[model samples]
Target: MAWSFWQIQELNKNYDLTIVGAGFTGLHTAIAFKRKYPKASVLIVDQGLGVNAASNRNAGFACFGSPTELLANYQHLGRDAALTMAQKRREGIEFLAHTYGKACDYVPVTSHELFLDAKHDFEHVVSELKLLNADLKSVGFATETFKPSLNAQLEINQIEICGEGQLNPAKLHNALLDNCRAVGIQFCNAKFIDHQLLQDDIAVELEGGMIIKTTALVLATNGFSNTTNIKPARAQVLITEPIYNLQLEGNYHFDKGYYYLRNVGDRVLFGGGRNLDFETETTTDLSLNEFIQSHLENLLRNKLLQNVPFQIAHKWAGIMGIRQDGTPKVEVLGNHIFRIEGMSGMGVALSPVLAQELVELL
Candidate 1:
């Protein structure tokens, strides 16, 4: 694909900042940078037509962290680090709601973490619920954010309710794109190939020999972080046809947040099963795995929507970036290049703040 003269000139325009990957983080980072440096030329580029990652494909839970997930984070990253991460997520969700407006079909519903019999320590989570809620309160979350309860009808040992919500992912993405464009930020749908550090600028090479030079660069590819410490993990999801008089509402997590389901109107949107095949799921491929898909279907039929009649409507997969420490990696790679990745499957609730944090480093 040879570029025309005008196209080449446009591609070669010197930008003050260039960001790769026009997903949640990339777009938000561009917005943040543009707001701070209104006169600076900013550009964002991505390979996909739209956000083809978990940003647009996520289950849309406006969640900070599930009880079990927070407990695990506390165990792995300790109390202080976990609290900090939680605070970021909380602030991120609030920022998103504020920016996009509450009319983006966001529902303030209770999120639940369900534990099956003898599978997890229900009492242990119950014991720590108060402590976890306190930790959240310390970070500005509402007190008693997590509480223990039981729903025998759901066949669970225990359930914890918390302040979480759901939103329209597509709406949020489009809103950000509109906001970015309205603010005079340029976006190009080109795949980033490589980047090199020049004396005073970073030369970013896109596919087909197109190069974009910028004084500063940001890599917000998240799970698509090809060369960084971020590991790509694919999550498969399916939605069911509308069921008659469906009573389920709110978001749900089971098996330590490995599986999740939420009511999309009268239909149920279910996803997650990476734990069943971590090796295979740890890839950037946006393809479904029958082994995992079948398990999800079985779980949906036997556990989630048992005795309820419904048909499968759609199935898809999205990739997420995971880090060993379960924290997003946002750091300055050089004076001119910055890298942000490892959302650890919490990009929806973390990217907004992470983007602002990345801009602060500029």
Candidate 2:
């Protein structure tokens, strides 16, 4: 596609900043930079019509971490680093609520980590519940974070409950886009093909042979980073048709946060099962896997709904970037290029503050 004269002129003009991938992080980064430099020319470019990643497709979990997930993080990353990440997640949720307002349909409910069997893993989580709560409190949580509960009706031996919540991801994304536009930020629906760090500017190549030069560049592509270290894992999700007398109210996680489900009004939005086929799931392809999808359905029917009559209304997949350490990566790639990716599936609750942190590095 050849660019018109005006389009070519616009592409030739150097921008103050150009951000790639208008997902949660990109939008927020643009907003933060624009707020700092109100008169600066800022442009956001995304490949899809809207954010086609987990920003809109996520299960909308306003969570920091489940008990078991926190334990794993603590063991892997050590206590201080783990607690700091948890603190960032909590602050990110607060920032979203304050900035986007309640119109995002934020719902505060108990997040549960269910243990299907009374096994050693369950015992470890139960044993460390108090320590987890203490760690959360040290990070400014007003009260205890996790407590043990039983749900005999679901045939679960134990559930670690915490004061977590959910929100509509689509609504949040729309709100961010609208706010960015209101503040005079430009957005273009074009894929970013490549970038080069010039002496004083960065040249960004788009899909249609358009080259945009900017003083600074930010790669907020998250799961779509396409870098060597960052691996994209696709998560498949399904929503069921409205069930009568739906009892599920809060977000639930199991098997170390690989599987999560939440109630969307009277319907259940369930996702996760990448653990079943990690090799196949570690792709940027937004297609469903029959093996994983079937397993999710069986889990929904037998364990979640207890064999209750229900039909799946929709199914989709979203890619998430994961790092070796299971933490987000925000750093400067070059003198003029900054990259923020590898959310490790916690982009929903981490991107807001992560965006701020990334912008501060500018």
Candidate 3:
């Protein structure tokens, strides 16, 4: 549906900045900019309902990476690149905590990935430790989480702890939205943004065919970002109805970060598996794919929750924008337009940090 510009009986006011998408990135960017220049007129426009992207639809893990995930990271991008990426994520999580605090259901539980294989891969374990420890030492940190004795408890394969964290994305979004309102930032419920660029000023053409002119423009709408250079990836997730005496703690990632599950009180929230059918999952639609949902349920029933009993209460999907070029963009695209995105699936932590970074640059 196209946007019908506010039928202002008709009067238009100039804005200093206009942000696209009210997701975390867009909302945070709005707050960040308003904070720096209180006198600036800031407004946000989006095509969807408020914060409906991955920002609110995520599993809420406030973490950097799982151990084996980091080892795989090292293999893919080498030690240096991997550590740099890990460090940014850690900092991003810290920034999120500082920004929202416990009122947002921000819990700091230690995340541990269990390695339970019938056969022990001690060699793979040693290689993982060497590379991971080197990466950690690069930042003057250490994790004895992989030490043999305790290692036996987690037992099975290679392990390394990235100290990743989790949080309630919706709660965080609500807080940011509240903050933006309190500070007097203007926001429209929805806008199509048919065209945008900075010739002299940022011009955002809405689906309603109304053109809003602002001094600058920021693109923060993850996944559904296809309105511009940003591309959306659909992520499907399922949650079980409340369970009794569920002992799951922190966040857990399996098969790299492709499969993840964690306890949200008595309910178990789990998602991921885009690796199963990347071709189909690469979409902006929030519709569920039966194949992914069935795969998730199968993994839960046969692998993780074999001994546990539960019933699925709800299932839904969210869109996450991929940094297709391998770079999470946060730079000037034109004279006064800034594009900030590409957090992969970890927007729970990365978005807020990118917001602050965007503000500093502004």
The lDDT of each candidate is: 0.82, 0.82, 0.72
lDDT of prediction 1: 0.82
Residues 1-362 of candidate 2 have per-residue lDDT tens digits of 11221132244347899998878888889999988889999888878755476788878888888888888788899999999999998998888777774868987788888887656377777788777888799998757778787876696655656657789888888888777878977777688999887877888899989888899999888778888878998999999999999988888988778889999999999999999999999998998999999999999998789958999999999998887667785877888688888887788778888888887887
lDDT of 1 by residue, 192-275 (tens): 999888888888999989877899999888888876477899999999999999988888887767888899999999999899
Candidate with more favorable, higher TM-score: 1 or 3: 1
| Model 2 TM | 0.94
Model 1 regions more than 4 Å off: 1-9
Could you tell which candidate, 2 or 3, scores higher by TM-score?
2
Q: Is candidate 1 or candidate 3 better by lDDT?
A: 1
Ranking by TM-score: 1, 2, 3
**Which parts of model 2 have CA positions greater than 4 angstroms off?**
1-12
Better of 1 and 2 by TM-score: 1
Candidate 2 C-alpha RMSD relative to the actual structure: 3.2
Best by TM-score: 1
